[model samples]
Target: MASFFAALMNSLDIALLLFIIAIGLNIVFGVLHVINFAHGAIYMLGAYAGYSCMAMLGLPFWLALIVAPVPVVLLAIVIERLVLSRIYDRDVADSLLLTFALMLILNESIRMVWGTGIYVIDPPAMLQGTVTLFGNVTYPKYSMFVIVMGMLVLAGLWWMFNRTRVGHIIRAAAIDREMSQLVCINTRFVITAVFAFGAWLAAVGGVVAAPMRAIDPGMGDKIIIESFIIVVIGGLGNFTGTLLGAIILGLIHGFGSRYFPEVNLLLPFIGMALVLLFKPYGLMGSGGR
Candidate 1:
């Protein structure tokens, strides 16, 4: 039972982090109708930036969190303007292929810049220890912090999309870009902003993940596949679906490897396949936009 509880805690943090990253992917798709295959690479860049801030520049983790995503976000903006913007009207395959190429470029660039070594970031000093819960189960403080941060982001996003003017504008534009422009909404700016925001979210996820996972170039490649699975299972462009999917996958990751070791690696893919086969629109997705 204690082990079960511990695994639950572990799954929560993992799920929330995945949710944070996957939601960004969903948001970009929801708004721009673009599949950003390079998102994980951007995430990798953010982690590297955080590492530079803390390890090399001697900045604290909090400051690194703030500073790390800047370059990634800027790069996202540049991509949107110089490359992605031009291909908006093209088929989805175009975005997929282009972003795939961009991912390759970014991965090689990271290798060139950071080398092919694994790096670890220590959790902030305040969060370095462990906390005990009921039945004497202990959990890492940093993981709890991650859970809190995820909840805050989830709340913030809900409020932004439901109660704020900017959120409304973004949604309106998503629903009808031409109509948004017809109403003087400056949809071009909104589109770019959404893409940048998605990149920002991905970068934030990278920064948060740095302390938990080993920082390496290949990390992005692994996460991109997971994020795709998450978004696909949850249904593209469905925020609620993304959250559910993250939690489900997180549970699979947390328990499958522990209890079902022989088939652990295959569980998530199996679940994804089942969802795809039975509910092509995803669990939370209704047919059509």
Candidate 2:
């Protein structure tokens, strides 16, 4: 029972980190109707930024957290204006191909700057230990921090989307760009903002994940695939669906890694295949966007 509880905690930690990243992908898709293939690269950028701040510049983790996502967010804005905007009305495949190119470019840029080395970030002093639970189970303090942060982010998103004017404007833009423009809403700005916001979320996930995983140029590649699985399992552009899918995947990662180590790498793919076969639109998805 203690081992089960420990596994559950581990799963929750992994699930929440995924939720933080995949939600951004969903938001961009929901509002802009574009599947950002470069999101993982942007996320990798964030982790590298954090590493630069803490390891290179000797900045504290909290300060690095604030500073790390700035460049990625700015780059996202540029990508939206200079590249994505031109292709917004184009077919979905166009966006995918273009963003895939962007991802390759970003990956190469990272290699050029940071070299092809794997790096690790040490957690801040406060989060550099372990905590005991259930009288016997132990978990990393940083993992707990990640879980709490994820919940807080989820609450904040709910409030923003449900109660704020900006949120309403974003939703309105997503629903009908023409009608929103008719109402004098600067939908262009909203679209840019949505894309940047999604980038921000992905970058933040990168920073948060730095301490938990090895930082490398290829990290983004792995995450992009997992994020796609998450959104697909939960249903693209569905907030509730994204959360549920993250939790489900987390569970698979936690238990599968422990009891079925040999096939662990294939578990998520299998789950995704099952969902795709039975529910083409995703577990919580409807027929169309």
Candidate 3:
């Protein structure tokens, strides 16, 4: 029973982090029809930025978390204006190719900037150790924070899309770019804003996960595939679907690592394949816009 509780707690953080990382990808896809292959690289950069702020500049962990994502958000805006903007009207394949190229460029650049060694990020002093729970089970406070942060983001997104006027415009533009523009919506602005916002979410995930995971140059490469699988299984543009898919993947990881360690790495892929086979549009996808 203790083991079961431990696994469940473990999956919560995994599910939350995956949701944050992949939700941005889904948003970008939903708004721009652009598959951002470089998103994981952006995530890696965000983590690196947080590490540098804390380790090199002597910033507080809390401050670093707040500041780490700004540069990446700026970078995303520039990428949209300079590279991604060009492919918006072309074949979707163009966006894919451009993003893939950007990913390679970012991977090499990150190595150049941070070298190849694995870096460590210590959790805040207050969260440095485990906290005791019922039945004397101990859980990491940082993981709990991650889960709370994810919940906050989920609520924020819900409010943004369902209650805000800007969200209405975003949704309208996403549904029909031409029609939205006819109604005087600034789709260009919305597209750029949404892309930048998506980048911010990815950066938040990276910054949050840095203290929990070993930071390495190959981290982005490792996560990119998982992000793609999450996006696919969740549906191309469905936020709620992303949540469900993230939870499912987290459970797969938790259980597979515990009982089927031999096939641990393959479980997520298997689940993704199964989802694709039975529900090609995903749990809540509406096909294409």
User: Who wins the lDDT comparison?
Assistant: 2
Tens digits of per-residue lDDT, candidate 1, 1-289, equal 8988888888888899999899999999999999999999999999999999999999999999999999999999999999999999999999999999999999999999999999999999999999999859988999999999999999999999999999999999998999998999999999999999999999999999999999998999988999999988898899899999999999998888678889988999999999999999888888675
RMSD per candidate (Å) reads 0.8, 0.7, 1.0
lDDT of candidate 3 over 11-59, digit per residue (tens) = 8889889999999999999999998999999999999999999999999
Residue-level lDDT of model 2, residues 1-289, one tens digit each, is 8889988999999999999999999999998999999999999999999999999999999999999999999999999999999988899999899999999999999999999999999999999999999999988999999999999999999999999999899889988999999999999999999999999999999999999999988999999999999999999999899999999999999999888899999999999999999999899898687
For each candidate, what is the lDDT? 0.93, 0.95, 0.90
Q: For every model shown, what is its TM-score relative to the native structure? A: 0.98, 0.99, 0.97
Answer with 2 or 3, whichever has the higher TM-score: 2
User: Once superposed on the true structure, which residue ranges of model 2 sit more than 4 Å away at CA?
Assistant: none
The ten-residue window of minimal lDDT in model 1 covers 280-289
Note the residue pairs that clash in candidate 1. Answer: none
lDDT of 3 at 84: 93
Better of 1 and 3 by TM-score: 1
